[model samples]
Target: MTSNPPKNPLHSARLSFRAPESPSDDDFFSAMVSDIDAYMNSNITNATVPGSKQAKKYQEYLTEKTLLGVVICLRSTHVDGNESEKPTPIGAMHLCKSGDGMTHHRSTEIGIEILDGFQGKGYGSEALTWILEWAFRRLGLHRVQVRAFGWNVRAIELYKRLGFTEEGRWRDALWHDGQFWDDVQLSMLEDDWKQRAERNLDR
Candidate 1:
């Protein structure tokens, strides 16, 4: 008999998280690349700014990194049609370790992107919350950090609402559109997550 695939981690509502099993699954590669490009190019002051190299090579990069356990893939899913239907990928979140050995074991950086039509529907928040829980609880991490472009107000707001505190801003770190944008860093510590959990219990 064959073993079953791993079960997905369910979130508060519709979103679910799973590992990407294959690069050939249901337009996953193309869709993910498109989402990355769309996110990078959105709200730009100049139309000619190029997308990141990672966006161009996301398939090979994600596959290799994920297999090496340097990155945890959070494939966000949602059900459609009926309960018998398999959930579809709506977005992806990734938590990447900073380096090898015990020195970097307690810290990780997170990145998330939701498909264009799926933004602002609470999916991003749910996905982010689930990943943070996994990072701190399951992985026993001391801190989780994320960086967002300065002009991405919506993303910055979501990060703040989810208990990440502003660590610092790298002045004019990203050159895009006709001007440079600050790369804002935010982080949540293990203590911070515990406090947020307590507040939720109190609610």
Candidate 2:
């Protein structure tokens, strides 16, 4: 099982995060691939693969991206003398760095997609916080950015509540679901993530 941690979970309090353990891992396939509901509001305007060809599509995705992406999972319950049970996957997240060499050191964009069944249960928030910490401290990134559609007030509000600043809005940048919507850009600097309360952005 080749994975980021191999056997251990990533740094999340209520969930497990790790690289895909296998190409055929059923849990991963269901949560990240076949789960159309999870991607409903995500706006996959750049998707290159058809829904039915997910396995190959996923492998291509892995090969094409310059980033650290992880499968988010529910921590497995430990049983007597059986602590090796695998966690159940629930979603995916990533920190995609800039492809431009000049900008690689200081910034990355984050994306979080939770399963429809798993949304709004604090799991996303927990995962986001841990990733932000990793971005600033572990990756030494100067800024971590994220984007949401203007209509996705829930996601934007969550990002703000967690310390991201509204950076800009691209007017009618994305045409989705029959209407053009603004792409709302937001970001958090290293200092902002570290001194959120001091900046009054953590409210």
Residue range 1-203, candidate 1, lDDT tens digits = 99965554543456656655553443664565556454583323224433444443554444456312212233334464234446666666677745566445578888776777677778788877888888887878898888888878888899999999999999997787678889899999999999999999999
Candidate number achieving the greatest lDDT relative to the actual structure? 2
lDDT of each: 0.67, 0.73
Model 1 pairs whose backbones collide? none
Tell me model 1's lDDT, rounded to 2 decimals: 0.67
Error of 2 at 99 (Å): 1.6
TM-score of each: 0.77, 0.80
Provide the clashing-pair count of each candidate structure.
0, 0
lDDT of 1 at 179: 86
RMSD of 2: 5.8
Tens digits of per-residue lDDT, candidate 2, 134-184, equal: 788778899889999876888999999898999999999877667888999
Worst 10 residues of 2 by lDDT: 43-52
